[model samples]
Every structure is written in structure tokens, then in C-alpha cells.
Target: MPASTSIARARTDAADRLVAADEPLLGLQLRCGGDLPGVIAIPALREAVGKARMLGLKLARPIIAQDGGDSVTAWVEIDPRDDGCLIEFRHWRAKPLPAEDEGHVARRKLAAERQIAELHARLDARQNVLYAAAETAELAELAARMDAGRGRPWTDFVTIPGSAHQQPLHWRLLDGAPVAVAGSDRPWRATLVPVGLPGAEPAGFELYLGSDFPAPQQAEPSPVAEQIRARMIGREVAPVLRQPIARIIANAETIRSRLAGPLSEEYSGYAADIATAGQHLLALIDDLTDLEVVEADDFTTAPDRIDLAEVARQAAGILGVKSRERGIRIDAPKEGEALPAVAEFRRVLQVLLNLVGNALGYAPEGSQIWIRLEQDGPMARVIVADQGPGLDPAQHDKVFEKFERLGRSGDGGSGLGLYISRRLARAMGGNLTVESAPGQGARFILTVPAADPAGH
Candidate 1:
């Protein structure tokens, strides 16, 4: 057989061992952790060759493989012979992997950790609790204890294994340690990540609590009833689907940002589009899940005394970077301002986030958004106002209706946010209302019962 500079050839035995190969193919085989006369190591090509040989057929396809820090792509034609398979490679190309930004990697890791964490806490430099949140009912008591003991070391509320020192151990020593929490039987692991300059004394810490196993589920129900409950999209399907969709978004982002490797501008733009679409799908899934919950007859909120001003500030902080990216400013309530109200803390935060996030999306670049707090006769109120295209009186009422976008499209909104938000407000004995005229901007106001002055 004659060899051409444009095409590379290789041969495999009946047992799928790479018996021979040309320059780049041979070099790639070894670079991908394969031996000279050993089995194929490139997963996609190996599978294609295996199928071609087994079926005694010829196959052509494009395959991609990673070689060291570069990505290799090629079109390969596999022909099955009597005793082996012949491999021909065409248009082989390799591109060096891109350099990833350290800050981006750190941010991605932090986001992943937060996604899996059941409980989260912010700690001061001395490890005193600044704030805490628990996602599960089982951890409610622990969160409450931490909230009540705000200035105390977080370790005081849980039992750490192997050490009985009176003082909390250094963050490095406590990170990834196992712990036991009160009012819960499941074993848990703790993660403590320091904040501030790389080599300087830490400014604060972020604490995360996770468990290898889920909390025990309720006793088994009748088969028919179980089947019906399992069909609930929110309770049964959403959790299973969220992880894979999130991965799709993350991978698309890596490609769009060229963090994995260098890509042509056209391909990079395609990746950007993919990431945007994935985000839209993820948002729709979330809205559907919330819709199911808020529409259920048994839905209710765990009302508690909460600070509306603090919630407003937290929502603003969460969206601050996004606002800055769009050249918009968020004027949140001052640190000293406090508006106590009786509502579910998490629900209020969710509603406020939706309002602020919507404002950021529609508000003109370089404009300002305001989160203001006020107290009526017996209700505590918070208003999110933005300088965007305002709604007319007719559209104001329709905005909160289910799946109502008011003739808008391509904005990546599901139109379920306001509806779900209104439902949640009503569940908490609160009301969400909008005040706006067609070109004067818009204000979304939420009001809930005020906390009793007597501490009732």
C-alpha cells in the first residue's frame, strides 16, 4: 500500500489491537495513553472501529479526542477486512487548549459547592456567624440556633469529631471535617472556604454542610397513591432533570468562553447561543416547579418575623454584579434601616429576587433601580422601582396572570415569575401590587403583616 501526506492509515487485528499506524495517528494514539501494539484508547474512535469490525461493514464519521492540552478532531473511515479493520484518517487538526482564568475557576467551584450544600453560613474573621440558611426542614432548628447566637463561633452549635478544644479550630483544620447536628440523625460533612486576599489574613469564611445520603423519606404509600404522587413533575421530575441541564449550561459556557480550548469565532458564537438557550430552559423548569407548588391546595408558608430591609439588601447584593455588568446601579436600603414583618423569610427573598432580576433585565443601561422600605398602618412594605418601559393600566393587572408576557418575546423570561410570586405573597398573608404608567417606569410593592411591637 502507498502512503500519501494528506491521509494517515492504521491497521488493527481481529482482537482490536493497534498493530500499525502512520505518523500523526500513531503519535496521537500514544499521546492519548495508548500503547504502540495495544488496544485503541480513543473512546469514540475505538467504539466506531469495534462496531465496523463486528458488523463487517465500512463506516465513516468524525471523532474528537483530547491529547494532553490540545483537542484533536478528524474524519475517519473504517473498513472491515477478513481478519482486521483498516483505519484512514482525513483532515486531522489539533488546537491548543485555552488558559483558564483562576478567578473563573474559583467562582465555578464555589457555585457548584453552593448547589449541593444543604445548609450555608457566612462567618466573620473570628468565625462568628454573620448569617445562615437551611434548605431542609430537618436543619431548621440548627439555623435558628445559629441565628440566635449570631456573635458566637458556628462550631458551638454542632459537634465536631475527634477534637474537644474549647476554641474553634482554625478554618483549614476544620474544612472537610465530619460533624453531627442536633435534631438530625444523618451524618454530615462541613466545608469552610476562606475569603479575602490570597496570602493575607482572611476577611471571613463561607461554610457549607452536605450529606452523602438524602434525608429519610416518609413511609411507603399505597401503590396507586404512590404512582400518582410520582407523576408530580415538581416533586418527581424536576430534581432529576436539573443537574444534567445545569451541566449542559456549564459545558456550553466553557466552550463559549474558550476555557476548554481555542475555537473559531463562528463556533464560539454557536456555543454562546447554546448556553443562552440552556439558561432559558432551566428557568422554565424552575418556573414550572414553582407553579406546581403554589397551585397545590395544601401549599402554605412557614411565617416568621423577618427583616424586610435585610431581605431587600440581600436580593440587591445577589444581583449587584449583573446590574453592574449592564451599567445599572441598585440603591438598596441602608445598613441601619430595619423593617420587621411577619412572612416566610425564604419566600420573601424569592419574591424580591424576581422583582429585582426583572428590573435589571428591562431597565435601561446606566439607569438606577431602587429597593425602598416603608411601613403602613399594620403592614410592612418594600418597593422595587426601576426606570424601564412601564406598563399601561390594562397591562399592569395582566402581568401577574399565568403565562402572560404582554406581547414580549426573546427576553428569556417564562412569564410565570410574577404569577408564582403573587401566589407566594398571598400564601403568606401578603399582597404584591404594581404601580406604573406607560412611560414613567414601574414600581412593584409587596406588603405583609408587620411584626408586633410587643414581640408576640
Candidate 2:
């Protein structure tokens, strides 16, 4: 067998093998310009192909007719074999003859050619719509799933290989990952491959927001956002405590009634302890819920240009009793021209109460917590400095960490207070920072942009 014949035979056999497997290949290259095979065929397509070949020849390059035929309609595909060449058979059909006449054949050939070309144009158009529709559905599913993931685990970028085809990964600020449902009528390959985020590239592919894998979160939220989320967790927790809180209140009230007249001393002690613990729990709930709601921006703020002195006075008033109970002194700066600062008055007071109250907890009995107002470049500032021992230099930065305690959890604390205060201050366009040294007490500085920041 000649080498050429051997190759042809191998191709013809390979086609037969694939066809045997029930996959009838289609010639669909005329669609979407992507060279897709086996989608649609035109009438007289084989005749038109022969004519197209003839048209490309020059005088010296007259097209040779394949052996024993005036024109070749289909070519055999020679596929590789382990021990020998395999031939694949392919067939194409053409209708209408030119009555075996040269002119008639030419005319038929031309007509067939025109028909094939038109069919190709239409097929290309159809292919575009097929892929486009698939992509549209994918994008829609992606958006819906993203919105639904508002509070679920791990969202953001999806890094799938080959996520984009011939095009650079498209979206600049994609909000959610593209989730896919298997077995859906959607194009998986050559349309969109899942990819990674910017800078996280895989060789031979780019990052896409849609993928078949899950991402592991690399970092935690920012401190401010962390604080917000921590407080907001109260909303998640309130349900669990609602019944318990109600039960406690009810039980306490029943015990206090004592209509049986003079309860036992041991019973009275138990009641008092229960009431104290319950009241403490209630206060914590209120604090957490308020912080959460404020941070969520669901509640309203009443901003006013009021005297800082008055805000301090109110904060001191509320905190003073608590301070006195702890034997701590709170010193408020004397009214100096009633220096006014713009803020959510109530929130400012809340911050003051939290901070001052917190300081008193650590201050030695009879130590002072001082509040003073001063000015720095482009801002008016309030300083809450305590005479109590301050944080260690190693731990100063950690002081604002949620649930971080100086000593123990039972030391009258939840580590969320400073975290919430700092976040709240910043959310209002101000900031709170600290200056401290171990055993030397700490000074917290809260600064805000003044009405005329420079006092100009």
C-alpha cells in the first residue's frame, strides 16, 4: 500500500470508529466563526465545497481531481494507532446533477456553492446566540446566588482556570462568586472557565468569578467592621436569651412577692444573687443591642452642635454613681466658654459612659478619671485619661481587640467595649487612639473635625 493510501485508509477507519460509538460528527464551522464541527449542513453542501476548491486555483495550479473522481466530496481522516494506521470513513451527500454536461455541472456547482455560503452565514449567527444564551443564564444564576449569600460562609471572587476565553477576565469589581449547578443545560467548556481573582493566576488560565471549588478566607474583617459585626451578633444571640431572660424576670418577681411572709434567710440570699446576675445580664444585652443597632446604621442619630461640657456632664452624671460605687473619682473640666462640638449627642454620651465606666473598673479605689478638651491641628479633641495603671506596651494595641481582657473574663468585663467605642467614633467621622505605659495609666484621645477645624 502506498504511503498516501495508507494514511487515507487510517482516517476512514477512525471516522467509522467514532461513528460506531454513537457520536455522529457534524460540520458546524460555518457557525460562530469558531470552526465548530457537526452542527448543521446545507443542501448540496458537498458540491459547493468542490466548487469553492476550484475557485481558489490559478492556471498553473489547476486543481487535480482525486483518483477516479472529477471532484472529491469527503476526505478520510487518518488517525494514529498503536501498531498500525487506522482509517475513518466520512460521507457527504449532494443533490441535483448537471445532466452530465460541462456547462450544466458548472451551473449546478455554482448554485450549490451559493447555497452553502448562505447556510454557513445563518449557522454562524445561530451559534452566537446559543453560547450567548448560555452565558446569560450563568450570569443570572451567579447574581442571585451572590445576593443570597449575604450572610453565608466565604463569598467574593471565584478562581477557576480558563474562566475566560481569548478575552482577559472581564469584571473589575465582581461582588460575588459564580456558582454552577451540574447537569444543567449550560455550556461548560470554551465559554467560561472558573478563574481566580486578580494576581492569583494559574498557568494557561485566568481567574473567573465562577468555579467548581470553594475559597478559603485569607483574613478577617477590618477592626471597625469587626467591632460592628461583633455587636451585631447580639441580634443573632437575642433569640436564644429571650425566653431565659423572661423566665428570670418572672421568677425573680415571684420570689420578691413573698406573700407567704418572711422568706428564709438562705432563700433571700439566693434571690438577691439571682436578681443581681439577671440585672447584669440585662444591662449587657442592652449595651450590645444598642451598639449593634447603631453600627448597623438602622437606628437614627440626633446630631447637634451642643456644649461638650454638657455632654461630659451627662456622661459623668450617669457614670458618677457607678464610679462612686467603685470608689473612683471622675473629674470633668470646668465649663470653658461652653466649647461646643458637633456630634450625635446621645451616642457621644454613650461612648463617654462606656469609656469612663471602663476606666473606673481598673482604677484603684479613690483614683481619678479626668476628662479634658483641647485642640490639635485641624481638630478639637477630648481626652479621657485615668490615674489607674495602664496597659503594658505589648498589649496596648490589643486593648481594642474584642474580648481581650487585662486579667480574667470574670473581671467585670466583656472585651467588646473599647472595640465598639473606637469603631463608633470613627463611623461618626472621628477617631479614638490611645497613649499608655504599663503602671502609668492610659490616656484615650478622641478627635473630631470641628465646625471650623482650624478654629478659623
Candidate 3:
């Protein structure tokens, strides 16, 4: 190879600290904010060195790093030794970073903020809290306080940095301000997005509370605690995995939507595929968490009197847009058509959602879905009927089995929905069953004890 592409040598100590390097490599390291005899600052290089050391292997690969306004690419060979690793930079190239689009930057920033936010709120024009939600127990107290203080400016609940003039600063002023919440030790950032036409007086705002750091983990656990942690999927594992997966989806969406700048159709499609897969993973995680709950020996539901018709309408309404996108229409029970039942309201709603959602997924374009209510003896029932490829009698039972997909692929389903839905129904003193013949569409019926009119 020519001198321009000649190898530049570097070595690290047993501690994995960069101990020595030749000219261009040394200069690049310093430019990347690292010092001689210091830890590798380039993330790609550090990872390669660590892998080589851990496996006691020799490897060659190309790595990219950013230095100021330029992107640096290099081909390096790593050889592990007793002390550390020897790194040979065989190829070195640098190119100026591409110009950034303002709109792209704004969209990326917004997506990132939404992904990291643990708390969210809807506020009126004057910044008064209308609704609030939190994902973790750490913010449960704050969310409760915000809910209780509805109609009051959200600023009353948290302290903003570098602002002492007064409470409830203008929306523009607090759009990206840092804040300190009562229960969280980590500093938080607030994002306020106005809800109105551009350049017009705002109607309301969407508030997101995000932190730069992950939630602090508890001190190291013993063997028993480790076992407990393993079992606490919903409480522990789900929350930890959600943020990163969400961020991955957000970034992929930004790229797929071209909000991050122009890209070839093939690359954009790849991004779309990535976003879809990420969404499937997220759904699977949620399903697994619910599976853990419904399968628990002590699992129970809070039964109450609820209107099956009302719940059916709600499920239809929630999935209205999705159905429309697929050219499917839902014929939900009309208002005032009530079939009162004794069951857990949310659990029943969940079952209906799964049924309706499944119908939407399988139903042919331009097909119709029907959500009807009926009184069967002492039981009240809601049936979700869809015009789709129906299931055989044998398959009907198999469909509700755990993780059963019936040979379908690429549909992004976890195959746990019906299983969990049935478990939820039984836990709520109800039963979920399906009826269909191949090529004749399908109907899913959910039945619960009829509520006593006198008691209701």
C-alpha cells in the first residue's frame, strides 16, 4: 500500500487504557477528545478493543468516528496480547459532515424528547394541567399531585432553572427548559408543544418530562433478590427496555418519514422495516408483561357493573382510525343500547380491543365489522364479528393457545393476545369464545354475568 494508506500503530495497557500511538492516530485521538495513555474515546474503537481483549482474538474491521465537523473512517486490525491489544490503523479517511436541515433537526429533537419522557401532560393555553400520566413509581407522586392540582399552572409543581421572575412563564420560554421534580434526583427537561395553527395564538400544549439519565438502580442484589428481579417482568424489566426500544422506533420513524433529510427509496424502506420490527418488539414486550400478570396464581380482577354496549363502542372508537386506514368499517352498538354486565370494565375493554384489532388485521379491504350486544339468559354478551378469512373449528381452540400463530407470518403479532384475553375474561368472571367456518368470516363472543337491574 502507498504511504498515504500505511498502517499507524497504537497500543493499550492491560487496563485497556491507550498507552501509545503513532502520529496521525495520536492526532485523531486527541481531536476526538482523548489524551495519550488515556482510555479510547472513539466508541467504535473502544468496542472493538474490548471485544478483542475479552475473546483473546485477532480481528479486522472498519470503524467510523466523528471529530468536530468531519467524519473519520478507518480500517483497523486488533491483536490481543497478555497485557492489552495492538491496534493497527491500515486505512484513514476524513470527510466533512453533511449540512443539516433545520426541519430535520427539529423533528429528531422532538422524537427524542418524546421517547425519553417518563411523564406527560396536557395543559390548557394558560399552562393549567388538564391531564397527566407517569410511567414509573418514582413519578407516581408527582403525577398524583398534578392530577389533584388540575386547573392550576403546571409550574407550581416543579422548579425551573435560571428563572425567578414569576411562576408560569410564557409557553415559548418554557418550551425546552430544565426542571427539578420533587421525587427524582436526576434533573429533568420539559418540552412544551403548542396546539394550534402556526403563528397563531396557542390553544393548548403537550408537556413532556424527560431526563438525560436512566432511573437509578438499587444497590446490588443477593441471590434471592435476583430471583425476585427475574420474576418482576412488568415492574422491572419492561420499564428498563421500553425507553431504548422506543427511541429506536422514534429514530427509525424519523428516517423513514424523511424528517431526517433526503434518502434513497431503498434506505427509507429499510428504515420503515426497522420501525415496524421495533413496534412489533414493543408490542411483544407488553404482551409478555401482561402474560406474566394473567398467569400469576394470585391474579384477580376488580369486578363491577359495566355496560357491554358502551365498552364495545369504546373499543370501536379507539380503533376507528386504524379500521378506516384498512378500508374496514365497524358497526358498533348504538347509543342507549345497553347490556349491563358484572365484570372488570378495563379487562372487558381489553378483550374487545384484542378481538376488534384482530379483525381489523385479517378482514379484507372494504369489509365490515359488527360489535353487537345481547342478553343470553343470565349472561350479557358482546360479539365482535368481522368479514375475514375465518378459522376452522379445530383452529378456533388452537388460536387461544399460548403463542399460537396458526402459520401466519410477518403480521407483527405476538400470538399471545387471544391467550391473554381469554385469561383476563376468566379472571373477570366472564368467558371468551369464537365461532366461525373457513371462508365465512369469524365472530368472537365475550360473555359475563348480567348485572341485576335493581342493584345497578
Who wins the TM-score comparison? Answer: 1
Clash counts for all predictions: 0, 29, 0
329-430: candidate 1 lDDT, tens digit per residue:
999997688999999877898899999999998899999999999899899999999999999999888999999887879988899999999999999998
Q: Show where candidate 3 strays beyond 4 Å.
A: 1-134, 140-182, 185-214, 218-235
Compared with the true structure, what per-residue lDDT tens digits does model 2 show for residues 1-456? 011211112111221221111112122123212123231122223222333334432111111112111122334333344332233334522222122345433433322222111001000111111001011222333333433343222113123333443322343322222333332332221222212122543111111222222222224444433433344444237434533554564455345333223233334346646755765675566556655665675544445464566566556654554676678878886545355566665467668877787788778898899988876665668788898788777887788877677675654466777787777777667888889987899898877655553344
Q: How much lDDT does candidate 1 score?
A: 0.79
For all predicted structures, in order, the TM-scores are 0.69, 0.44, 0.60
Residue pairs whose backbone atoms clash in candidate 1: none
Q: What is the per-residue lDDT of model 3 for residues 12-121, given as tens digits with 9 covering 90 to 100?
A: 98888999999777877787678998988776788889999999999899887655556667799999999999999976877775666676557555766776688888
Whichever of 2 and 3 has more lDDT, that candidate is 3
Worst 10 residues of 3 by lDDT: 221-230
